[model samples]
Target: MTDQPIRVLVCDDQELVRTGYVTIFSAQPDMEVVGEAANGLEAVHEATRLRPDAVVMDIRMPLLDGIEATRRLAGPQAADPPKILVVTTFNVDAYVYEAFRAGASGFLLKDAPPAQLVNGVRTVTGGEALLAPAVTRALIGHFAERLRPGDPSRTAREDIVRTLTPRELEVLEHIAQGLSNAEIATALFITPETVKTYVSRILAKLDLRDRVQAVVLAYRIGLAGGAA
Candidate 1:
């Protein structure tokens, strides 16, 4: 691998899928397909060996599943975990939500364009989580509809919430809705620059590292639930 290439490990049960990813990523000057694994177990083993910057793991596999594998590799309990980007053919919304809960940095459809796949890796490697706007809305809605009232963690969530200014909260609500910075700016009648600032501040105040965590926190705390 080149010193500057983004090293990636492709893990899937299907040989064609693995080969396809290798071929696509190999063609990119900024990326390198460092290794391939046929199942979650192998994925974890190879991840430990290669220590790649990003792991492209599928949701299903033998010997172990991606969810557990992701937790071992990137979960809150992990001592050292690589960023995981889940790859799946089915757009089943629930699986996407579970992937995030398992600490995935992003989720990309298997049929997504090669460019998007590459970009997904780059985004996660750059310390950002890739949440498509549509997916974001679905997750927030799902959590909002199911969240129990008077949650014990409500206080902690509120403590984090209080740090946000009213305008920052507005931007955050839009973010939980899966709105882009440009869309948020237009909706709030502010410049996109201001919206970006709000996003940065929100991340800082909430102590979240990226948008994916923000999205998860929004659901965890009922901020993005219900009408808002």
Candidate 2:
């Protein structure tokens, strides 16, 4: 919302892909391509130097992969991490999960169209999460594709729930179901602003970076399956 354009760092080893991203971002009035990196290590360095508002990260890169770079730049241990929107291939769902666990705010498939890609960067910077690519929505199954009952994260799941208020728990349920704030507001009969507030509180309470993590936690705890 500020007049200042969002500064962005584009990281991808593919020349045409990277150049396409730069061109798309360049055409946006509200976004500026601030830097570029061919691999994860350079991404870290440029991210450190440019300190961009968001990073358009590809999961595969030379020298270092995007997962490790995302971890170093957006990991829990990062002193002041920049928002990261991981761009990955649909076939490598494992990499997607690892990127999320590594602290990426959200992810888009490498094939996502320009608008969704741009929206992804905005979503992360807006302090919300982005996890949908139309083709990969059901492909990834809302972060539950790899999730099943009885994982180690299940133990932490209760701890995740214990940290939230009752209202926050409700918000988490809707988020896990892939409802937008407006939809959640409609379902809960509250204002969208209230839904947004509850979302912020939920993320803070769970020590999560965004709603994607919140949804993943919900499934991990069986909230979607009526066990939580």
Candidate with the greatest lDDT versus the true structure: 2
Over 4 Å off, model 2? 133-146, 149-155, 226-228
**Residue 120, candidate 1: C-alpha displacement in angstroms:** 1.7
* Residue 60, candidate 2: C-alpha displacement in angstroms: 1.4
Sliding window of 10 residues with minimal summed lDDT for model 2: 133-142
As a whole number from 0 to 100, the lDDT of residue 62 in candidate 1 is 94
Tens digit per residue, CA lDDT, model 2, 19-101: 99999999999999999999999999999999999999998888999999988998878978899988887677678777877
Q: Find the 10 residues in a row with the least total lDDT in model 1.
A: 144-153
Give the Cα lDDT of each candidate: 0.80, 0.82
